[model samples]
Target: MKKYFLIIVIFVVISLLGFSIIPKNPFYNINWSIMSALIIGLAMLAFFWNFEKQGVSSKEVALIATMTTLAAVSRVPFAIIMSFQPMTFIVMITGYVFGVQTGFMVGALAALVSNFFLGQGPWTPWQMFCWGMAGVISALLGNKKKEFAFTKFIILAACWGFIHGWTMNLWHWVSFVFPLTLKTFLATYIASFPFDTLHSLGNVIFSLLFGKTFYTILQRFKNKIIVVPLDNNADIV
Candidate 1:
């Protein structure tokens, strides 16, 4: 745990330092995105090393890798198919079942891979952080199974969407505006309202429709993973 804390601290500090040092929109081409993925993957590899010390199951690792990879690939299809976003739902469901640690990895890795195809930019790290956190948040929420209700899922998805929109807006906030004024921040957040809405709606609908099943499938790979019946058993919890 302490190692995780130190790692997070380093990542945050590096993120801020890189933000100030790297030119605006550093992720403009395919090469840079691939480079970024390589770099981020290295960092993730190290982070996972710590967690694996406690005996990381091969099933969990394989599941995260496969699911996240598929999630990454799905981004382009989502763009071509329904025009919906790629991965917030997938990662969140990942977090819900497999645990937050798994979700974070899934979200971050998915972002890393998607960046390769979508092209990279200064927003790469932030995008990685946002999607990764979706998984983490799912894990955090999932830990408290007592409150796992359908309505709560909507609220959580919307909340994650809002945060993601605002975080993405922060990139613009830094590039376009300076001094981080309240007016600028608030305006940016407000401007993201539409995307935020879709983000949340996507989460709600996806989670309501498939989160449990997806999560159920996700957990099946875990050692002794529990499978819950889909029938309405609100009182079960």
Candidate 2:
């Protein structure tokens, strides 16, 4: 835990460094936040490997790399604000696959790494916290399936996305620009609510399309690691 904490600290420092240099407003920020995460994330990952690259299995390395790449690439359209892609999908998947801690870590780290292109803003930390919560929430929702296969899980992931967006908007309204206020806030929820709905919808659609494939992929390596149990507690398996 201390090690992850240190990584988060480094993540924050890099984020602050980039954020300090950028102009206010999301428009001018770019993805500095994600970029900072890349540097800190790599450094922290290297640090975890003791800068030696020994003992760590190639598969474990591959899993993290795959998750990071998927998360990063999935977010590109979001940065351009061109579509309603829920980056939360990957985050929820991480948590559902590996448990709460891994899920939260991936979500936060992915956002941090992706910040490289988005430009770090005052909202960086909060965004991390918000996305991180999405994973944690998935863990709490457990593996209960109201339907067959992954229908219930997909619903949970979708709901989590809605929750993520609504929470972020509220955060924005309060902390509109870091040291935020109710007055300075744009109160854009009216405008952004549709985006939130789209995000949730996208999560369900995308998860339905890709989750089973990821599940199959995970099964190939399931025995090697401690797989998270989405079992009797749920209606679906």
Candidate 3:
């Protein structure tokens, strides 16, 4: 519990400080946001490796892959709308149902795989980070609860939408704009508000309409696929 809280705090602090420092630092010639994003993404990958590598079953891996694929494909329909994507909805639900590691993998893989079609660039890592964080955070928030409520899910999704947009805006500010400032950040956020709102609303609507159904399906699948080996002594002779 404390470990998770510490990780979240460290990540948020690093991200905020990185955005503030990267633009002015003379040592960083290229886009600093990308560098920071890469570091953050790598750290998350490492965390997943260390924590889940030994215990994760084949069924869990398949489940993560399937969720990632669904999240990636779900972006296609909303491509025309700019920021609206069902990816968030899928990710939130997956995280809520599964554990943190599964959520992180689904979110990160969804970003990586989807970019093949959406055109990968510096923004890819940032997208991966934001979506991945969204899942991780959602899972953490729901850790104590047995069943998550629809309203809470919608609220969380909406909050993540803004967070996602703000994190994404960091790249553009660092790469295109010079000398990052609060004014510039505000401007970027203001410009992006509508799209972010769309994202939030999309998440809310998707979760509201399909949340229960998806939860049922995934819960059933989880139950059906899980395998527990019997103790050697329990075997009938």
Candidate 4:
């Protein structure tokens, strides 16, 4: 509950800051990028704190780091492809196997880390938020069961491709597009349609080909982490 509330607060704060609600603030005028990064970083820290409160073990922390690295590195090989990468799918699978908090962390970290190579700007936080939501949504849909229906997740991945694009579009629109009218909004989205479609297709392809394998592998590790050994000296009741 606290985590979900914090997520909402993060979104609201970012949205407000982006729109310049504080009017003519000198610090915001000087360096909005740093400000945005700082806010998003703190938000990530809040989630990390939640993980600590839940008593996340060293093994789980290592697993999360491993998955985050995988998701980030996977973007490099496909950098030339416009809006087509397996990172989103990988993040979703991680979230699906691990749970919401872990998923969000992986997704957010992937965007942040990958941007080191891809180049970061004001867009970094938006990417983090969008990808993080992808993980959260996937975890919500598939984390409860030991087995998941692939078709459902495939469809979800496809849809999230557009959702991710549209959310980013909203950032672009709000930040750059003038007048904030319906026509400009539609124009912005229309211009991005092709790239968004490719992203959607890429997600579908990845999900179809590798979703189950990734899920199974991660789930196996997750199960191992959950296991507890009995004391040999203890007698049976």
Tell me the number of clashing residue pairs for each predicted model.
Answer: 2, 23, 0, 0
Writing each residue's lDDT as its tens digit, candidate 3 over 93-195 gives 8988786777888998898899989899877777887888878988887676767676888889888888888878877787677677889878988988998
Candidate number of the best TM-score: 3
How many angstroms is residue 85 displaced in model 2 relative to the true structure, after the best TM-score fit? 1.6
Q: Regarding lDDT, does 1 or 3 come out ahead?
A: 3
Candidate 3 local accuracy as lDDT? 0.79
> TM-score for model 2?
0.61
TM-score of each: 0.71, 0.61, 0.82, 0.81
TM-score of 4: 0.81
- Minimal lDDT window, size 10, model 4: 27-36
* Tens digits of lDDT, candidate 4, 1-237: 766868876886776576565566654453444555566567666766777678677887888889989998999889899589999999999988888998998998899899998899888888898888889999998857867779899999999999999988977886777777999999999999999999999999999889878888888888888855486536652
Q: What is the C-alpha lDDT of each candidate?
A: 0.71, 0.64, 0.79, 0.84
Give lDDT: candidate 3, residue 98: 80
- Model 1 residue 226 CA deviation in Å: 9.5
Looking at model 2, residue 143 earns an lDDT score of 51
lDDT of 2: 0.64
Q: Please give the RMSD of candidate 4 to the true structure.
A: 4.3
Assess candidate 4 and give its lDDT: 0.84
Better of 2 and 3 by lDDT: 3
Q: Better model by lDDT, 3 or 4? A: 4
